[model samples]
Target: MNSSATPVAVDMGSSSVRVTAGSFDGARLTLSEVARFPNEARTVAGRLVWPLHELVERTRAVLSAVADEGMSSVAVDSWGVDHVLVDASGHAVAHPASYRDARTRGIPDELARRGLTAQGLWSRTGIQPDPINTSHQLVATLRQLAPAERDDVARVLMVPDYVAHRLGAEPGWSRAICSTSGLAEPGGGRWADDLLRELAIPTEWFGDIAPERQVAGHFAGSSDVPVIRAGSHDTACAVHALPSAPGPRVFLSSGSWSLLGVETDRPLLDDAVRAAGFSNEVRTEGGIRLLRNLTGLWILQECVRQWTREGVPTTWAGLTRDAVNAPGATALLDPDDPVFQTPGDMPARVRDAVRRNGGRVPESPGEVARVVLDSLAVSYAGTVRQLANLTGANPSCVVAVGGGTRNDLLNQLTADACGLPVAAGAAEATSVGSLLAQLETLGEIGPNDRSAIVDASFDVRLYEPRASALAGLAPPNLERLS
Candidate 1:
C-alpha cells in the first residue's frame, strides 16, 4: 500500500457537493478540501427536479482539480432515496424529480388502499415507510409514464450510484444506501422480493447490489487507481467517521437533515420501532442504523436563503452569534412539521408556525434563527430518548457530527435537553469516512481498526449537559401530539 497517494472522497449532499483529498501514511489520515459547490433542485416545466447534467459537470470539474495530485482512488457518497431512471443505452430518461416533489403526496393512502401497510413493509425491509423513499418515487414515475415508456426503462440508479457510474465504475447499487429505498431486505444484499412483486415493480430494474468497501472499478482513464464503493449513502459515511471507542454512544449526523441513531449488529424490526418513528437503515460496516430523521438545520438554512434574497446576506456564524443572546424557547414549533419540509418563505413560515402555536412570532432575523435552532434542539432531545428506549441501549454520550456541530448554541441546547454530554467533531466526516473506506479496500488499513484510526485522526469538542439551558423550556412532547 502506497501511503503517499492521496485518495479522493466525493460527498454529494442534498444542498452541496464537496471533495476531499486524504493522505494516509499507514498510521494516521489527514484530509484537505479540494472543491465545494452549491447544488439546488430546479423547477423545470412546472416540476422540481435535480439538474443531473449540471451536477455531473461540477463533479468532473472538482475531480479535474485533483487529477494531478497522485490520486490513488476516489469514492462517492450522497443523500439517500432519490434516483435516476436510465434507458438501455445508459442515458437518463429524464431529469430526476426532487424528493420533496408532490407527485407522491398520497402514496401512503395508496399503499393502504392496496392493503399494504407501513408495518408490513417495515417487517420485511426494515425501512420506515416514507413518501420520500425511492419506492414511492418509483411508483410516481411509473404512474406518470405510459406503458410503452415504462418498457423503455432499463435501470434505476440512486444519486451516488449515478455519480459513480459517470466516474467509470460499474453500474451497481450500494446496499448501504439502497436500504433506504424501503425495498431492500435488512442486513442483506437481496431486495424485498415480495414487496417488489406487490408493488408491480420489475425486479430486473436494479442491477448487482455491491457491499461497502469493494473496488467498483478504476476511474474512466486511469487503470491503477480503484474507485471504491464507500457507503455511497452520505449519512452512512458520516457515521463511519465517528471517533468513538467500543461503547454505548449515539451519533447525530446533523446537517440539513439530522439523522440521529445508533448502530446495531442486527435490525430492530418490531411494531415498537415502527411506532417510534425510527428507521432501520443499513450501516456501511455490517449492521443496522436504528435512527430517526428529525428536520434539522434546513429551517435556518432556508431562512438565511430568504434573508439573502432580500438583500441581507448573512453567514451562519453571524446568525448564530446574533441568536446566541436572544431569548430561548419563547416560541417552539415542531421542526418536523410538514409545512417546513418544502422550500419557500421560511422566515415567515417560522413566524407563522410560532404564532399558531401560541408563541410570540419572530420579528427579526436573529429571533427567527433562535426559534429555528431551539425547535431543532427540542426535536433532537426527544428523538434521542426514543432511540434509546426503542433500542434499549442507554448511551453515555451523544456524538454530534457534520456542519451543525459548529453551532455552539445548538450543541449546548442538545446536551441540556438530552441530559448527556456531547462530543462534536469531524465536520468533514462524510468525506473522511469515504476515504477511510477506500483505504480499507486498498489494504492500507485493516477493516476492523478503522474506528480507532478515526479516533486518533481528529480532535473533538466536548460539551457537558448544562441544566441552566433547560431551566424554563418545556421539552417537546411528540407523544402528546400522537
Candidate 2:
C-alpha cells in the first residue's frame, strides 16, 4: 500500500449505503463521505427482496470514482443475517430476501414441530431463535424450491460477502457476518454442521469463514487496490470503533434495532441467557458480543412514513422537539411487540398496544413518539441490568453508537433509565470501524491505536444520568410484551 493511499469503507446499511474514504495521519484519522444513497428492499414477485443489482452498481460507481484518489484498499460491511444465493459464475441466482420478509414468519414453529427446539438450536449456534435468522430463512427458501432448482443454489453468501464477491473479491464468508447467520458456531468461525444436517440445509453451500481483516482479492479484478474483509458485520465494525475503557464494555448499536449488550470472552449459552432473549454474536477481534436484539427506531421511522403518506410530514428534529415537550408517556411498550414488527399504520398500532396494555392511548404524533422513546430507554436500562447480572461485570458507562445517538432526548433518557453516564457518538460507527480495521490490516496503525484515533477523530458527547427523569416511566418487563 502506498504511504499516502486512502482506505475506503463501504457501509451497506439496511436503510442506506455509505461509501466513506479515510485518511489517517500519525495521530488522527479523518473521514469524508464519497457517496451515499438510499437502500431499501421492495416487494418483488410477492417477496420482499433487496435491490442487490442496484446496490452493486451504485457501489461500483462510487469506488470507481474514488479509485484515482490514491486509494489503497476498500472493504464492505453490512447488516447481518440477510444473504444472496449465487451460482458458480458468482451472479446472484435471486434477489436476497429482506429479514423483514414474512416468508420466515412461522418457520421457527415448523422447526420445533420437527423436534428442533429453540433451546437446541441456541445450544448449537448461540444465536437467538428468531425467524429473521439466516438458518430459518434458508429453511424457508429450501422448502419453497423444487429439488431440481435447489441444485442451482451453488453458494450462500451473506450480503457483504456477496457484494464483495461482485466487486471482485474471492468467494469466502467473512467470519463476523457469518456468525450472525445462526448457521455458524459462536465465536468459532465454523459452520454448525450438526445444525445444518438437522435443518436439512446443504452443507456444501458454505465455505470456510475468512478472518475479519484479510485481503481476498484486488478491487475491480484488475485494480491494484485490495478488497479487505474488515469487520463485515455492521455491528462488529461499529464495535471496532469503541474507545477503550476498563471493565466490561456495554454498547448500544442503536439503529432500526437496539442491540444492547456487553463484550464477553466466550459465548454464554446457559439457559438463563437464552431465556432472556440474549444472543452471543461474534466480535471482530475474536470474542462474544452477548447482547439482546431489541426493537429500536424502526417504529418511529414507520410512524414518520405513515404520517408522510397521510399528508402530514414529520422531520426528526421536529419530532424530537415535540417528544421533549410532551407529557410523560402513559404507557410503556415492549419495543419487540409483534404489533410494531411490520411497517404501516404505526401510530395507530402504538395506540392499540397502549390500549391493550390498559394505559392511556396517545392521541397526537408527539405523544406517540414519546411513548416509543420512553419505552426504548426503559428497555435499554433493563437490558443493561440483565447484562450485568449475566456477565457479573459492572460496566463503567454505556456507549451508544449509530444514527440513534443523534437524538439527544433518547440519549438522555437512556442515561436516566440505565442510571449510568452515556458516551454517545460515532454516528458513522460502522464506517469508522471498517476504516480502522482496514488501516490496521494494511499496517498503517497498530491494534492499540484504534481508541486514540477514534477519540481524536470523532466528537463523543457524554450524557449524565438524571434520576429524577425516571419518576413517571414504567418498569421494564420484556415478558409483558412477549
Candidate 3:
C-alpha cells in the first residue's frame, strides 16, 4: 500500500456507524463513504445495551472492504462514556450498557449519601455529575454483580477502544474520551486517583491513557496498515474537524446529542460554569472543551421512531420541512427535561411538558416537530450566550457540525435567539476530523496549515437571524420561539 493513500475513518455514533475513505492530495481532499450501518442498542431484559459482538461483525465487514483499497491506516471514533467490561482474555463479561439505561438513575443520590457532592466532582473532574457518566455506570454495574463476577473483570475498554481491540489493536484508553468519564483531573488528562480511591475503583481496570494519534496496532489481515488513535470521543473529533481557523467561535456538534461549547486554552472551573451545567472535557489538541451536553435530537428522534412503529413513517427532511412552516412560538419545552431522557411515548411526553410549562399542546406531527426544533434552537442560543458570559469569549459566529447541520430551521432559529450568525455544514464531521488526525499523525498534513486545508476542503452554510423570530422572544412563554 502506498504511504500516501488516504486512511479509512470509522465513526460509530449511537444511531449509526459510518466508514469513509479519504484521499488527500496536496491540493484537495476527496472523501468517499464506503459503508454505513445502523448501530442500535438491544433491549436486553428491558435494559438498553450495545450489542458488541454484532457491532464488531459489522465493523469487520467495513474494514475488510477497505483493506483491498490499499489503505495503510485506520482511525476510529465513537460516543464517549459507555464502555465494555472484559476479562483478562478480552471476553466481555456482559453486554455494554447504553448510556440511556436507567441503572444509574439514583447514582446522584447515592453519591450524595457518600458525601460526594456535585461541587466536589465538578472541581475534581471538570465534568458535570451526570448519571450517564462512566463512573456512575460502573458503580451501578458493580452493585448488580456477584463478588466472584466482579473479581473476574480484568480490564475496561471504551466503545472505540474496544472496537480497535477487536481489530487487533493494542487495547488502551484515550485521554480525550476518558475525560468524559467524570474521573479525569480538571485541565489535566490524568485519571483522578483520589476520586477513584473514594469510589474504590482500581485504576488498573482502566488501561494506561494514551494521547490522541498514537499508533495502536495493525488490522488483523492488513499487517502493514497502522491503526491510529483518533479522538475516541466523537465530539472531540468533530471539534477538531471544524473548518474555521482556531479562534473563539462557539462549536456546536449536533447529532443525537447537541454538545455546545467553546474551545479554550484552559478549563472553566468557576462556580458559574458549574451552576450553568457546563462541562470541561479534554480537547485532542491540548485544549479544553468547555461545553454542555444538551438533550439534542434524541427526543425528536424517539418521537419519529414511535410514529414509524405506529405506521406513520417520516424522514428527517420531511419533519424539518414541516417544522419550518409550522407556526412558531406556539409551544416550547426545555430540551434538558429529565422526563424525555429515556425512550418511549416521546410525543406524549412532549405534549405533557409543553402543557406543564403553560404552552399549547401540539396535536399534529408537524407541530410537535416545530416545538422540538424551536426548543433546541433556544437551548443552543442560551448555551452560546452563557459560553460568552462565563468564559469572556466574544464569538462572532456559531459553527455547527455533525448531522444537525441539515436542520436549516434549527440553525436559523439558533441565530435569531442567540443574535449571532451561524455557519453550519460538514455533516460527516467526526469522520473528517478522525481522518485529519490520522493524516496529521502520519505527517501528511502540516500543523501550521491544517486548518486552512480543512477550510478549503469543506463548505459552510450561512444563516442569519430573522427579525420576526427575534421579536417573538420578547414574550416570556416564547423566549425560544425565534
Tell me each candidate's TM-score.
0.96, 0.96, 0.96
lDDT of each: 0.84, 0.86, 0.84
Q: What is the lDDT, from 0 to 100, of the residue 395 in candidate 1?
A: 85
Ranking by lDDT: 2, 1, 3
lDDT tens per residue, model 1, 1-482: 34765789989887888888999877688988888888988788777899877878788776765775578899989998999888887778888898988889899899989988988888888888999998888887788887777888898888888888888788889988898888888764788878888998888898767789899888877788788898899899999889874469999999999999998888888888888888888778867888888889988888988998999979888889989978977888888888888999999998888877877788878889888888777777777777777777788999989988889899998888778888997988888889988888887887777777778888889999887565335434356222
lDDT for predicted candidate 1 compared with the true structure:
0.84
Give Cα distance to truth, residue 373, candidate 2, Å.
Answer: 0.4
Candidate number with greatest lDDT: 2
Off by over 4 Å in 2: 1-3, 469-477, 480-482
User: Between prediction 1 and prediction 2, which has the larger lDDT?
Assistant: 2
lDDT of 2 by residue, 265-366 (tens): 889989999988899888888888888888899999999989999999689999999999888746777788777887679998988878777667888889
Could you give me the TM-score of model 2 versus the true structure? 0.96
